[model samples]
Target: MSTKKNNPSALNEKAGISPPEIISSNAIQQIKESRKKQPSSQELIDGILAGNITALSRAITLIESTNSNHLTKANEVINGCLPHANQSIRIGITGVPGVGKSTFIEAFGKYLTSLGKKVAVLAVDPSSTISHGSILGDKTRMEELVKDKNAFIRPSASGETLGGVARKTRETITLCEAYGFDVILIETVGVGQSETAVHSMVDFFLLLKIAGAGDELQGIKRGIMEMADAIVINKADGDYIKKAQLTKVEFNRALHLFPPKKSGWIPTTATCSALTQEGIDGVWQTILDYLELVHSNHYFVEKRKEQNQFWMIETIDEQLKTHFYNQPNIIQLLESTKKAVQNNEISPFAAAQTLLDSYFKK
Candidate 1:
């Protein structure tokens, strides 16, 4: 009867089985705006310690900010949360892109929550070095975990540092720990330089790998292999189950070639399917066993202490580099020096020395 012959919307009713809203968006936005209207450090700390997710997210956002203005506030929040942190077991997970890290974390996180444990996931998404852009779609990928009240999934901060781990990630862990999360899972992007950084941060290092995809003997990386506390061959269902098992055997053999771990815990290797939820519980058991061994041998507390010291020196190196590069003269000279070095005008080390000279002169 109308100008339009038919309306597609009239063909179907609303989905009655849609998931329920945990909290209204309007309510959350209103709360955020109110708190953002000049929240004191202690107020944010109070909210975080009281187990308020919004408050926890806001504090983490502040910590990840690069603005100089937020530095003091961020430091205050970290100092406040420090006393309540180090109470949780931090696990770092890394793998190549398309390794199903997101799916695995979601499945693993849900399993932990089912056991009455609070889980916080800091997931990394693919980032571009040229554009400094990230999709940040991990929250969407982890559909079930996002809906679970006992779980918190945060897409790790992107841009600037593309080494898988996020900026100020350790600070974020402290904040999550203070918020009463029992398990903190840090998911890094790749299996390269980032692994070293992530390895030093967590008590347990889990490497997620898939089967029959450029995963041959050549893929055996001794450096990453040595860092791993557990190698989980994911996507182990369907036709690939046998291949996964073979991969597991290969990894187990490769792990044996490495020296013994200081924690007195041998790296565990197993296969699991995130889709079918198979072997998910075994991963948790492996972690518990490692915890028992490390705790009993006194490596738990000592490892954390060593990590703290490492970060202190690392922060100094980072700040010095940032300060050096921020100088007006260094900014002006860097471009010219880059062109000269690219043209074979100066040795790489000499170019570096030149920049250092200019920075010190400034």
Candidate 2:
């Protein structure tokens, strides 16, 4: 009895399964040590283009790094991958906390997978620390769907951005496409204004809401609603079922008050329960309808081009600001200028002009 208990194969036999070799702890350590050389950025890119998940993860890691050394290679990888990008559908989802954003995505992702479509999810945690890295709570939140072989979930470290979107999310989108993920879902921090940043990159923007006592719209900013391509009132089952319908009508009216979408696509209102999976199909159908309308008018292609241009400029602006703030002399100048303004030694506009002049001169 003692010998059987000590034998590893005994456990498998008791469970009616075949026995397998169990690597020793020393062997495991050696394997990990051997992996230290890690693949190069180009190898990762090749793997991504070949649709390797491991390579995709490593490529994203390179893009997320602030290390100066990785930046050049990262750009090269992106340049090589650009020709293969833009073939995927990019969707952005946002809502207040507890609005069931993750649940909705899981259900919708499963639905998409069932239709033989490949889905890649990049869930922006928005609270991750650069020092500690992302904890990836979304993967655990989406337990069922995460197990599906066809799905890929990447939880981004939010860094200092308002949206949970990581600094490299735009590049991550391109990498996902190279990996053959035809449907890419980007989920942002539920905080409303940050939704705008996510909206700027996506082809379709979805806003989720919970049925409430007429105060739902109050918590959501008008700007967010205005940017939304569709409004989904989630948790639309059981106790909230009736209220969901009423909220849908209210949203339809509210959506009309805002200007029409840039694609001339009408905003749709729907109710869904990520728990019971109710109305999930309708939400997807609504998205397809909007996509169909936009594509027919050639807004799809034109809008994507505009988005690419916007991102290029946005990245440049952000890098310039970061460089400006990080300069030791500029930091000292900024502090001195602040004190001068408080003491009434300089007008705010004059200080700003001086700062700009100095900034450019440097």
Candidate 3:
């Protein structure tokens, strides 16, 4: 006590033990303050245009936020970034579950970055309807791309959206494009109407398939195939090579049965081994060729215009539905109306009319 140790390390030395490093309270306070600080919308837009990954990530989080205040900020950010978007090539990739979508995207994104192209991978993960939560594990699965500075990977929950894509994915794409990403890859939540939703948003749609899965058609709907600009057979290596080739031929034949796409381009089928990085170039080349073909025919611009119009109408419908359901009277009546219909106390059409009338009156 007479010779007081001024430092914890000195006291540890007296006790013949090593001292654990400690952070000061002031340092912790600084960190808390930094985290609590929210950037202005203009700051976010400037950071995004400057290619700041942190700002881009924060902007996306804002877009995904459910809070009304955050949504207002997110809309402001979107408006700021919109002028800089629509410059990148947007590609939608979809397949049945277990079709190696994560693997293929990792390989494809890595290849694109090697060519000096900035790539962004947006993954839509299936969410539990009961919990409304998703695993959000695509970034973990795509380990290599996660380490690459040129590649940005984001995994979003599908929420209640029917198409296996997040409600905010289109806006996210705009933000990615604004960040100067040359290529945008949207991975849908396996197979379903998600393919159609993705097809509506992307410049090119790629359907991934695998062989030796018994069904061969692989549970992929015929409608999804019709939407594809290219069908790629994954796992085309080692013993599966022959099976992949046969699958390619089968897909080509099947694609011929559908009417031609409005793009005036024929859909092609190819094989690739994402594990081996084999034939990845061919797939990219096929996309390039399609781009050239569509641009030459002016289909690319026209398709984008059509997509914009489609989304506008879609937004209106969604808003109207949300407005109708969020009304207090509708929420109170919804369960009772369903019960009445089930009990045959009221006709289904009459129940619907009553609900609509209540909503309009409110």
Output the number of the TM-score-best candidate. Answer: 3
- Candidate 2 residues lying further than 4 Å off, grouped into runs, are 1-33, 128-135, 216-220, 331-356
lDDT of 2 by residue, 239-273 (tens): 88999998988888877788766688888889989
Error of 3 at 266 (Å): 0.6
Q: Per-residue lDDT for 63-168 in model 1, tens only?
A: 8888879989989999999899989989999889888988999999999999999999987665676777788999999999999999999996455553756348
Clashing pairs in model 3, backbone N/Cα/C closer than 3 A:
163-194
Q: Model 2: which ten-residue window has the lowest total lDDT?
A: 4-13
Local accuracy of candidate 3 as per-residue lDDT tens digits, 1-362: 48886655643446556678798999999999999999999999999999899999999999877675687899899999999999999999998899999999999999999999999999998988789888999999999999999999999888776565635898899999999999999999975578878888999999999999886756556788788999999999999999999988888888888998889999999999999999999999999999999999999999999998988787788768977988889999999999999999999999999999999988
Clashing pairs in 1: none
Which of candidates 1 and 3 reaches a greater lDDT?
3
Q: Is candidate 1 or candidate 2 better by TM-score?
A: 1
How does model 3 score by TM-score? 0.92
lDDT of each: 0.88, 0.85, 0.91
Off by over 4 Å in 1: 1-36, 339-348
Candidate 2: TM-score? 0.85
Residue 158 Cα positional deviation in candidate 2, in Å, after optimal superposition = 1.7
Which residue window of length 10 is worst by lDDT in model 1? 157-166
Give Cα distance to truth, residue 174, candidate 3, Å: 0.5
Tell me each candidate's TM-score: 0.88, 0.85, 0.92
User: What is the alpha-carbon lDDT for the whole of candidate 3?
Assistant: 0.91
